[model samples]
Target: MPSETARELRRRLHQQQLISAFGREALRGAGLDGLLQDAARAASEGLDTDLAKVLQHLPGEQCLLIVAGVGWGPDVIGVVRFGTDLASPAGFALRTGAPVISNHLGGEGRFRTPQLMVEHGVRRAVNVLIRGEAGAPPFGVLEVDSRDAQEEFSESDVAFLQSLANVVGLAIDRDRDRRDRDLLTREAHHRVKNSLQIAQTLLRLQLREVEDPEAKRQLEQAARRIMTIGAVHERLFSGPAIGLVVVATYLRGLVEDLRASLGVGDGGRPLALEVTPASEEAVWDGDRVTTLGLVATELVTNAFKYGRGTVTLRFEIAALTGGGTLVVADEGDGPPPGFDQAKGGLGMRILTTLLRGGGLAAERPPEGGFRFVATLAPPPAGNGG
Candidate 1:
């Protein structure tokens, strides 16, 4: 048999491992209920106890609600409450913000044993307060209980339980901060999309009044650019991640919108748009995705104006660098041989401008159609992408 000292050391190590594991999940922003459940389980396991629970304090009622627990009947968790006064075991920890240990609850006189605990035959319990933001009311108590009448809890056990409680507190604060920022970001995107839609509507109205073909075309192009931006905002607003854009999903929606507005392609055929990487994933930065969308629009518009048949858009990610290339191809013959892309039409100019002075490479594939390639810089890392 191992020495008592060795067993104690092993227990301490196990408790530390539990704390680290729970800390990781909490920092990852797991849902509040999930965090509470995890914390309760960790506490019970770390203390070698048979039961554990996280009690959420209700300030107005001066009571604690059993929000999460382990080794409890279905009728108890989420259905039981305890008074938050000095007389209650867990309540004493919450009210005084101190750790509580009751090794002999049955013989104890300082605090009353909860009726549920009495009925369950729990003879020992340890409690720690889970704090919230400074000046905010305490969240509630984390408690570990044992039905084994002889089981004992020491100071080190209290320290481990307190560490777990601290992690829960930090996770609550972080989750709240993240939600607040998301609300602000969504509001900003909403306002910008609304403003852009208004501009697009005004441009459409002006387009109907203009008689000059050149001015009318310019206004239409401008309106389409604004619409492209609006479409990006729409995608961002609906997407789960705040700053990341799923390339395929956004592009498919954009292509559908363009097809609706532009009508048929050459020879009066239906306007056909094909996007590679059919999967709804492949995320990238929002701003870069917006730029790619505009670039695609200009290229697709050029294809419809000069080329014919289906317009195929392909996006390829550079596995090593994260940068990628956007290829827009059409079945029709490309610009006449010897044509200068840098000095070509307005669409070409806009493409180069959107790409930050970078130019596209024109190619005639062996399959007998035109292909334009625009290389993009590697998207920035992080930002939820």
Candidate 2:
């Protein structure tokens, strides 16, 4: 038979394992609410308490709101609030960074209206403070309750509760940091998209004054290219994650816009743009999206202006055999045999410069037609690798 001390040690080890498992699972959970509830339940188990409650300070309401609770009736869970009164045990615990303990809730003078505790059959209680970092206001409080009046909590119990409070504080902070980063990223994408639109508008206005038709055409194409990139940013701004972009959806929208901009009439008679995917999904960063948009704009513009027939855009992604390829082909009379893409017109020169700057190679397919093939570079380290 195991001694009481051995059994207690075993129980503690099991509780610690449970807490660790809960923490890992909570990180993978969807929202903060679920994590908070799971943390409270785990803390209650680790602390050997019948009930646990987590109260978060609501600055706007100027009060502490119950974020999670275990073993508490709905009435008590939703009805209690810790006001700003320093005399209150909950408030005092928060201010002093000390756990408030009441061996006998009904008889403790400092216990705030023990009638509520009696009504809930909570005879012994401990209140743990969860303070924010360095001079910041306290974030919240954690309370544990026991139904047995004689169940006196020891100093080790207080220490354990404090450790649990620390874990809860860290979890809350991590969730808040994640949410803040996501919001900032979305806002940045929105501002960038708006700036791109303004630039595109300015380019169009400048094109109106140019006497050279080719220059004007290039300017208009540049504006359309900017708009296409802006559309990708717009999609990101509307989504929860701004870092990953959907390649297929973005390309389809860009193709539709190009058809409209080039005056490809309706009734299914637009520039025959077809995109073949090497994978079901290809996600890219903002810079890559911008480069791809510029390259696509140049190819589509060339096809509409000079290609004799329909145009096709193919997107392919292959695993590990190095970089992927983006091929834009037009069924027009192929570019003059042995024509150099680098020595072409101003637009072609700009396209070549952009591709090379992006660490990509641009070339015409030797078989026929005008084909712009760009190799996709590997993503930088520490980015979802």
Candidate 3:
């Protein structure tokens, strides 16, 4: 048989592995609540203790919040708070970035135990400071103990608990990063929404001063185009994707809005629009989606204004370059051949830029009316990717 010292070393190594595995599993969740519970579970099981608490430091309040716990009353999990006095063992351990142990609270004098701990019969326990990244402050504390009065914690047990605390600390860092990114994204969405509203208001204001009916109609179209792009940002903010956008869903909603905007076309006839997709989703970043959205608005609007019968939108994916293609086609007569080069404005410029390297293509298929088929540039896969 192996010596006692060798067995102790083996035990410590096994506990380290267990802590690492559970730490990662705990961090994988939709939000903070799930993550906390996971971390608490990991700590309790790894330490073979009856109780464990994952505490969060509340600097502003100068206290620690028990965010997660195992083997405690349900009411106490998020309800308990501990003062951060340096004189107290738990607080001192947090302040000094060290571990503190109490063999038995019944006869202890150096540190005071909380009223809740005494009620729960927490006889012997160890507290370790859960720390964050190198420059950051501690996340909280991990406390574990056996309920039995006969239990005694050794130095190796304290070290094992401390390792568990460090594992949870890294998870806290990841969660913090996610929260920061989400906050910035929401702020960006709010600013963009305001800017689009202002642009729409300006276009409407200009529309009221036009002398010719045709000019007024053109200005109205411009306002609607801005609204289409605005709709995109709205959808982006609603979904979980941080950096990418699902192009198919965005176009579906945009098509519906386009139909409503141009209710009647030429002689007050009801206008109908349809979209055909490959049933697969495509992801793209902000700039690329913006470009594609603008292109679709121009083509779909042109089709409704000048074409007859039903208007259809077609979408395809190009797996090779990780981008996709969109075709806005109608049965009506197509734009003149020189139409692409003659109009050097913003919308046309987008098309011209894409058409050169075959990233986009526009053509009037000889079979029917007009069609603007654009092969979008290979854009970054957004949050969905």
TM-score of each: 0.85, 0.83, 0.79
Q: What is the lDDT of candidate 1?
A: 0.85
lDDT of 3: 0.74
Q: Which stretches of candidate 1 lie over 4 Å from their true place?
A: 1-17, 24-33, 58-63, 73-79, 83-87, 107-112, 265-268, 277-280, 356-359, 380-385
Instruction: Write down the lDDT that model 2 would get.
Output: 0.71
For candidate 3, lDDT tens digit of each residue in 1-385? 6698897777777778877777667556446666667667766776677698888889999998888889998889888998889756678788888798888877788778888888887887788888889989888888886677775777887777777777677777878988899899878987897899899989889877888998888788788878877887777764447656777777777777776677653564444434445424666666666777777787777677767766777777677766667787777776555665446455566567644444545576768666777776554455234
Q: What Cα-based lDDT does every candidate model obtain?
A: 0.85, 0.71, 0.74
How many residue pairs collide in each prediction?
Answer: 0, 0, 4
Which prediction has the highest lDDT against the true structure?
Answer: 1
Q: Distance from true position, residue 238, model 3, in Å?
A: 0.9
1-385 in candidate 2: lDDT tens per residue?
6698896787678666866786677567447677667767876887677688888777787677777889877876657776645666666677677788777766777756445556778878778887645666778888778888655876766676676677666766777778889888878888998899999989978987999987887788778878878887876643335676666677777887888777776753346555554544666666766767777777777766777566777776655542356776676665667777668887687677766634334455677656666665655665531
Indicate the residue-level lDDT of 54 in model 1: 96
Q: Which stretches of candidate 3 lie over 4 Å from their true place?
A: 1-3, 22-35, 59-63, 73-75, 83-89, 95-98, 133-137, 148-151, 212-222, 260-283, 316-322, 335-349, 354-370, 377-385
Best by TM-score: 1
Better of 2 and 3 by lDDT: 3
